[model samples]
Target: MPKLKIAASLLAGEFINLERDVKEIEKAGIDLIHLDVMDGHYVPEITFGRQIISTVMKLTKLPIDIHLAVTNIDHTINGFMQLHPRCIFIHPETSYMPIRLLENIAQAEVLPGIAVNPTYPIDSAKNLLEYYGGVCDVLFMSVEPGYGGQPIMHKRLQIAKNLRPFVRGSMWIDGGINPNWAIEAKKNGVDGVVSGTYVFNDVQPMKLNVDSLRGESLSWRTP
Candidate 1:
């Protein structure tokens, strides 16, 4: 089994002190920084654009896993690739030509991935996952795409288990990914997790939460 990694979502970080939060997460050994690039037309929310992604690039050297939840696939793809994200994920439902876009991303030497919503049929994306030397990966959504802080759709976990054998690349789960859910995802062949509120929550220190999500023993720091 591949190692399970924790990707801390920047969407749930402190906007006022974004750089600081990113640095702290880097110190805590986060595997990647999950950036949600949302366009208001596709998803109800508007989030990071090229500008914010550029600034984040300066903040940390960690690999960036950009999730593009936008309608204009060509335009959005053209814009974000300039920043050279480690992995670029697009929602197939929003794209008119998802396979082409995935191929384009691979041709550019950037990792390509598809984001499958809760209702998208798993088999619908099977061919794309096998395309272009199997560079295409997957981001399985456990909740709706537009917003955060939603509960994990437990049913989706089974999909990951069922598709694990067919996926040549990584499989990740997003939304409501706490320590317990992270464990469950791993059991279901998920290679990584995108955690927002749970990772950045204040009740427990971020490092402790990150470690716990990896199934390490919890260590406390008394105030």
Candidate 2:
């Protein structure tokens, strides 16, 4: 099994001082930076663009993980690639040709990932995996993607559990992932988690919260 890791979601950080948040993440030694890119058509919200990604790259050396919850998959991928993300994940439902898009991402020397929605069936990923399973990472959303601060869902966790055996590469759970949720995610074969608000909440330092999420501490409580 791959070692569990945490990707701090920028969407969940302090928007006013995002640079400071990135610096704190770098200082605390979190695994990666998760960028949530949203297009209004696919997801109801709109988020970071290339400029934001560019600014973050200048702020920290941590790996950047781009989650494209957007329409026009190819265009978004091309625009974001200029920042040279470590991995780029796109929704299968949004892409006209998911397999081809995955191939293109690999060709660009970036890890290609597929993001599965909370309501999506576990079997939907099997076909995509059959074609590009070895080269791809699977990200399961524990809540709906467009918004933040939603409660974690049991059905979503079950989806991750069900897909664990078939996934060849890493499996990540996103949306409302906190320490307890992360523990369940790890048990169900999740290698990494994408956390936002819980990680950047005012109640605790980001490092400690991040550490708790990774199961480094069991006595974590909000201040």
Candidate 3:
């Protein structure tokens, strides 16, 4: 198993104090900065556009994992590619040409990732996953997209267990990920997790907040 990587999800960060939050997360030993890019058409929320995401890219030295929670990935992908993020995660259900999009992302020298929602089981994407081969990675949403502060839905994880064989490289789990749930995620074959609210809390030391995600049983102070 690969060493667990923790990504601080900016969807849960304080937007007004983004730079400070980015610095704090990096200081906490975060491996990646997970940026959730939601287009209102796909998910109800509308996160910032290219300028904000570009600003976030400049804020941290850590890699950026941009989750494209939009209905049309093909149309807007080039915009994200221009920013040169470390990786771009797109949902198979949303793409008109998922393989082509993944190919485009890979050709752009960025890791192309496929994000599976809790409602859509990974098993169902087996053919696409298999066909894509080395072109993309996997990201399982332990909770629903669009919103934050959801708990890990164990039943959904159970539903997604069947497609573990198709993972080509890294696998990341997002949404409702905290210390305790991360343990369950690891068991389900996740190499990284996008933890937001728990990690960006105002109560604990940044390092403690990060280390706690490594499966420690510390009481989280609410932000």
Candidate 4:
């Protein structure tokens, strides 16, 4: 397998010093920047909106990846599209017309993907994978409601195996991604890991924290 790419989520960074945090991530050679747009109704937390994401885009040279965890997918999506994000992942559960929304994202020239919740069935998404997934740059599997150092729920690794056959692009796991979990992810065919707390919630320099995630290896045996 190729090296694991790390998409660091800036939400977990110190928002008061946002510019400095962005600069730190850029210097760390982080491969991608992951942003979450959440409405209180959808995921219980209201994260920032479009303008903030646009600001984040301005602060970095890295590619921006977005997860749409909002209820108003139709009204809010266009604002993000205008920013030309690297990839936009819409939870298939949120849209009544998910296929159409995914198509709209493609029309705007952004890579479109489905973000499967940990409990959502892959069987239900096979067709979605067959269609939009083929052209997508990555399949973003959220395997964490997990923290940075806890043992990965082995079941989560199973999801990667289930997704391995059809995903043409890379498979990325979001949440609770540490090096040990990353080794197991590679064994299961996962190509990238997304982390917010792991990258930002530390006294370690951002370079040490961010670099720790991307260049993971399985050379040593992992049980």
Candidate 5:
């Protein structure tokens, strides 16, 4: 089994001091920075845009994964593509042709991933797996999107386990992931874990929580 990667979600980061939060996360040895972009339509909230993403891109060299929690993905994909994020994830519920969209993202030379909400059945994304030959670089399973500090729905881990054989690349578990849950996610076949609140809740300037989570994730190997 591959090593589990640690991704820090921006939703739990200090929004008031966005740039500073990202810089601190990078310094914490995070593998990737996860950005949740919600457009009021798909989810109840609208958060950030290309301007914010561009600023974030300028702040850190760490790979960025943008999760599009919106209905109007097409309206913003190009703009975000220009920023050259390491990976872009669009909801299977929002995209008209998720597989084709993933293909387009791949054609742009960026990693393409599909985001599945906790309630959405993994079988619903079967076409994506079939058409793409299960080649998505990342599979983001959201326990709860557009929010922070929710409990990790164990069923989502089952979804990740179900996709293990079909997924050719990496599988990322998002929403409410902390050091306590990282080991279970890895044991359940997750390739990466995304944490937001667990990292920013630390009062220590060095981001002890973030560093500890990353350290804990690395300690769990595939047996």
Candidate 6:
């Protein structure tokens, strides 16, 4: 099995000093930077836009994965494509034709990803399997979309496991991932773990917490 990677979601980071926070997270050895873009219609929250993402882009060389949690998939898709992020993940619920949108994202030279919320059954995304099973670059399973620090829903993990066979690229677990759950997700065949609160809770230094989480993930011996 491949080693599990960690992506630090910036939603829980210090919003007051985002540039500083990105530097801190990069220093902490996060593999990828996860950005959540919410439009308040899909998840009842409004987050930063391309400007913030552009600012973050100037700060780090790490690959950025932008998760679009908006109701207007077409507008969001067009808006973010201009920013040239490393990867783009759009919720299937929001997109009228997710498979086709995924193709458009791929044509734009950015990795395309399909995101499914915790409440949606894994089978609900089956239409994508036939069309994009091997084509999409990533599959993000969200326990919750808008905010950070939510609890990991065990059912979501099971859903990820169920979808692993069909997912050809990488399988990412988003939402509520911390040191404790990272190991569990890894053991169950998750390719990457997306963490927000666990890395930037302000309860401890962000770097220290990330280091500890990485160590915990490394220590787990899969059976």
**Candidate 2 at residue 20, lDDT?**
84
lDDT of 4 at 6: 83
Residue 105 CA displacement from its true place in model 4, Å: 0.7
Cα displacement (Å) at residue 41, model 2: 2.0
What does candidate 1 score on TM? 0.94
State every prediction's TM-score relative to the real structure: 0.94, 0.94, 0.93, 0.88, 0.89, 0.90
Give the Å error, residue 182, model 2.
0.8
Task: Give the C-alpha lDDT of model 6.
Answer: 0.78
Model 1 residue 179 distance off true place after TM-score fit, in angstroms: 1.0
Q: Per-residue lDDT for 1-223 in model 2, tens only?
A: 5556989898977778998889888876689999998878888888988888888888887899999988888666787766679999889988888888888888888888899987666687887788675668888888889888888887777778878877777899998777888898899889999888788786877778878987887778743
Q: Which candidate is the best by TM-score?
A: 2
Clashes of each: 0, 0, 0, 0, 0, 0
Tell me which of candidates 2 and 4 scores higher on TM-score.
2
Off by over 4 Å in 4: 137-152, 215-223
lDDT of 1 at 180: 81
Per-residue accuracy of model 5 over 141-222 as CA lDDT, tens digit each:
6566877888777677767777777677788888777666777778878888887777667554434665556554343211
Write down the lDDT that model 4 would get. 0.74
* Residue 101, candidate 6: alpha-carbon lDDT: 88
Poorest stretch of ten by lDDT in candidate 6: 214-223
Instruction: For residues 86-181, write the lDDT of model 3, one tens digit per residue.
Output: 899998888788888899998999989888887775556778888888856788887889998887787755655566778887778888777777
* CA lDDT of each prediction against the hidden true structure: 0.84, 0.84, 0.81, 0.74, 0.75, 0.78
Per-residue C-alpha lDDT of model 6 across residues 34-79, encoded as one tens digit per residue: 9998888888888878899998998999999998888879756887
Error of 2 at 197 (Å): 1.0
Question: Which has the better TM-score: candidate 1, or candidate 2?
Answer: 2
